[model samples]
Target: MGPGAGEVSWRHWICDARDGRLICPIDIPSFSWDMGIGDFGFSTTDKGAGKIDESGLTLPWAAIPASTPDERSAMLDSQRRAIVTTWAASDDPEDKGTPLFWGKITGRDDTWLDTSFGLESPMAILSSRYAVRDGAFKDGHSSDSIAFTGMSYRGICSELGRIATDGKQGGELPFDWTYTGERGSHDRTDYQAWNVQNLAVDQLLTNIANCQGGPDIAFRPYWADEQHIRVRFLAGSDADVYLDMDHSPVCLSSFPDGGSLEDIHVSYQDGYHRWYATGAGTDQGTLTCYVESMAPITQSMDPPVLREAVYGDTDTDNLDLLRRHVGGVAQNNSGKLMQITGSIDFGDTDQFGVPLHPLGSMWPGESVTLSIAGFPTLPDGDYGLRLMEMSGDQGSKADLKFDVLEAPFQ
Candidate 1:
């Protein structure tokens, strides 16, 4: 029997616009699915702003046999309108069965009888909120006029909730979401203002992340189905899973075996040691602040180390506050950095060998502790690593790339 309507398998389905239900597409010979989270890092020159990379999915269906040209045309049309609410669930019964990805069809290409569908994670929805007004006007306005002025991370999410549910933007948000209320315990007395006149929601969130100090914070959003979305605020090194070589589900005997860490890169240039800040003011007399890394300068490095500056506009002129700002920047750039990219086959079962969520089923920003035998550089300890990007087809195999979180100098 054909798959029933609203049935979900390790396959793609188009949501019926009329009734908002998932319906399997016709003539699917073969299909592949891949999805993952994006890599986020600090930008050296952008005033410590966190740089968020994009995450998405690529699904391609093999030669679908269409008996008639009219049938082919209808299929293409249906796919187009249906891209807005594309959803997928793994065939693995033990898999969370959550919508692995909720995305809009980004592209569609047809050749004879086969069609390919491109999908991106819901992050696209967040990025869609961009600066709508000019920065100059926003800079001129005081904090009192901004909606989220001096709001905590929780408060910020509440404001975002307002935006998503108000219906002023037309269609209701496809998924329901809530703030997890996770934030650092830093003094929030330093009032920060955002010009809501034209700023997008994502831009404001990015600014908040970059400027806040203490534990690094992140926002992650995921969907289980068309009607539910969960947003979580994660603090530094908050790992979702801990994988050990002997106890973990990883298949030690498989091809590509466990995983490998490589591409070690390190640098300590003048750019990494200096910080500059331009305070709030008109062109004529704005104060410019400079700070240096606490790490003692090494005389051996050529081109004598120079200073880096972070510029911003705020009401505070207190030198202590300025020092605090620059200090945060210096600490952010102090550590030697490295990255590991490889695939680990989680043996098809849990530690007890019972079949469960396929090995390698993970998300971006999720942390994992590795206890592999090789690689002396990465000792068998509880060092936290965040998954930056992951990809794999449906089954027991998967690949992941991640960044090692090195502790900043205290």
Candidate 2:
């Protein structure tokens, strides 16, 4: 008999990096994995050092009762020096398993006989590989120097793709990349000129992400199969696949009546109105630009606020680009944003006696609608939420968390 609905099946194996062999784990007990693709911003005393930090997926697993003591020892040895791969699939036969996560074993915690493994995606490898030397730009350049001026988003990503496939950096590694078209108006043209002298691949990517007026591009690298890797760039304004809450076969269950919202804050300040772009050339000078949002300033909120952000090492003096950047930052930081946390009912039946939405079909970055009662502050209509984090295990329901951004034009 085939596996029933809501039942999950998983495969855990230790992969040999040298010869590409797979060894299955023994007596796996429980597993939980978290995967996210987003931007993390950090600031310090240096105003120009702000960056858009990107992260890959992280999967940690636990095992119980090894087949033998020696078997456990071998697993530990492999965890120290071997690649690990995990595959997951629902009981539905039609569901031909998906390669959930794969990477080198970064860490492990072990008792006398039991063990757990910590894993990160291949992006970790790319982020760690830095330039050992530098060279001038030549025809078919093989060195690590930022060799482009006024490069478009596609151009920079294309160069990174070349480096990844050059057999020296990570080309020989098992990953494929797909660079989407420019999603933002500013990204269509050269937003800024890059002159990075010596930097790691991850650092260059971060610089590109921090480009003034650049779209929020996500570098998501995940397993395409047991061997192939798929790198995707999810950008702002790009049309995403929408998951309908009212019609989805997978039903979402809520707590405290349904869902709850908190952390609502709004602010306005002069710093958000002004943008300073510092150029990087001998003759290039600092450019100051200002923009104003038509939205009325809310004065009733307690604790008036002011937000100021600075972008350094930028080569663009375009007023339009600066205006776009300042406007987006102002709108995002000056409005009310909330967080909605809930769970999806994959194992239980709904009130109408129908199976809930299948948790197995969800992925990060997908849009979801929430329509529930019990929140007097929240409006009655459906609220759109973006899926940012998810956690689940076999034989139980999974949790879904979302970020609610203030709607523009409202």
Candidate 3:
């Protein structure tokens, strides 16, 4: 049973062995009050001696000696610190894999677990020490690649070249999960179609123009014709490809000309409804898919568009861009972007109100300038501005403005 019955939770503790000996070089750090699978918060409620041996932990207040209560409490506290550090380090570095010890891991994410694939993961020593493949520590030297739970990685990166790889990152590998664990829209469909056009993996393509497999399958992308999949081609050697077998059948269609629906039709192969493609790509080429529920090139939500720009030597161009943000931007996770699709130009008399394009689509990490033309050239002044969400989901306007300067682009 997981926690209660049959479900495995992300919160867990793992005992570890190194060279066949019990060591304090690994640990599981936990912080939960409801489910006590592993709850160690150095509580004033009960701080004392606890035995952590070959079997597992059995820490309780009565176990410590009265004469050394402070010392025992201090040791466990340090161990707790080490464990927290290890937990943070083991929690998915760049969402990739690494080889480092996370001695103790006790938490509640469902997909986290042990490894059978040779690929390494962060390890925890039940509640003692933690490890990550991150190399180097400041001052230029290798800190212990394996550290007791409560220590520090203050200077550990540069010193160790990242526990196993060139410390390009830190932490544990992401779970190789496909199921989103959530259902779709009002539609009862539990699955979604994914498309990676002209998908290239490791270093090989999965398509061959007008050709099927033969004795010498020159640059051929193989489809089972029965299974309807262009599986990873394993020739004289296991060719590298990233399309995992975990993929399931999902509808796929093509739009050769990005045309309307009536122009497209279903394709059949070997007399089975199981096969089809839109011939959406290059004529000789084919798209291999069992089903396709959505299109490959989806129209992104409209970003804020700049209507018109009037450039000049100074602030004399226009003073209206700041009058009122007629149409703002759309947003997902990485913050808002400007989109002025329905914006209106109030005419040259108030020409400044026209939304002129800034640096186009403002991506997550890019910055650009937005200017207005035809305003009284002045040293500095405050202008009125407003920001809004497209749907007005929040039902409130962000009443804000910024200071503008008359300084020309120098």
Candidate 4:
């Protein structure tokens, strides 16, 4: 009932080749009843309510094929996070302010086995392991509370804020607080007017969304005076990576130019690293804050951000120009680099994208792979590899356009 997972423990169902399981794990989010489209943010209805998984942008959702046994071992040994197939409570939707927890639902999105590789002898059996956990937060911080989870949309954070504002300490609910759903504005319209302590709900909402964009954007409280948090975008193919995080040069001075995860300390407690409140309001004891990660959606994730300069010739006629650009920004973070394992988007309608391999053709579904080792997939023509970087919502996202410059879609 306390805030935790792992200790409560559960069994990791071993996938069997004999039983025959085949699907791209990268496409789980598109089929996830809780995080995917159909179910939206609400829990499942039918006990076994299910949807065929469609390959979508890869963000390490539970949908990807469960990690290979070796990959699982390495993940636990390396990353502090563990892998598991999380789940949501399968009941009570119309309860209005009901809180739900996520468990047995780890992974990026879908958990399936890649059958095409035929790595496991075309019949090799691969499975993932699971260790039981206690004090799992999924069961709710307490029997009466729920764990922090992706709530679905960026614009509807008020649903979650409503709960934190009037938490069940037996106090009055926030029906009295002015509510508005304007884009980018904090959930409560009266956010600035609230007592200091009450600002927690508002600050938390912003912080959660900030976290999804990585360390580039700080999710701290906004004060009425002084400078506000400024944002910068580093463009990439299919996704946008943010660079500026309202950090001062003094703080950047301490950051190592190059180091492992262990060498960096971005201050998880401070506004940039972790979460914090803003605007020292006098009476309400300075609005406090607590934030969860941004809500899960089928949005494309920016991979490693890339930055580069360009030199080119322009056709000023009709602006029908052709140019040669050397390097652009990474799709994920802003580190000096030429290449990285990243993801971007074409558009909401163009979801088919995957890690480019050698000699492969286009396919149906949101997930795809282009293999070009010894064969041709793209049509013969001049194709432009244009990278984009956009900033908004105090963060940014991007897309990589691979189109024929002088031809039609083949």
> Candidate 3's residue-wise lDDT over 201-313, tens digit each?
11011121111210111111122231121111111111211112233221111133321111222121111111232223344542222222121123335432222222111
What TM-score goes with each of the models? Answer: 0.58, 0.60, 0.18, 0.16
Instruction: Judging by TM-score against the true structure, name the best candidate.
Output: 2
Please rank every candidate by TM-score, starting with the best. 2, 1, 3, 4
Which of candidates 1 and 2 is the stronger one according to lDDT?
2
Error of 2 at 67 (Å): 10
Worst lDDT 10-window in candidate 2: 38-47
- Candidate 4's residue-wise lDDT over 171-282, tens digit each? 2221211222323322222222112233344343433333333112111111111211111111111123222212221100011232111121111110111222223334
Q: Which stretches of candidate 4 lie above 4 Å from their native place? A: 1-166, 169-339, 342-410
lDDT of 1 by residue, 37-94 (tens): 3212110111134322122222233433345667545544533333222223333534
List runs of model 2 lying over 4 Å from the truth: 1-6, 16-28, 38-96, 107-117, 130-155, 165-170, 180-198, 206-295, 298-327, 348-355, 392-395, 407-410
lDDT (CA) per prediction: 0.41, 0.44, 0.20, 0.21
Model 1, residue 175: distance off in Å is 2.9
TM-score of 3: 0.18
Sliding window of 10 residues with minimal summed lDDT for model 4 = 117-126
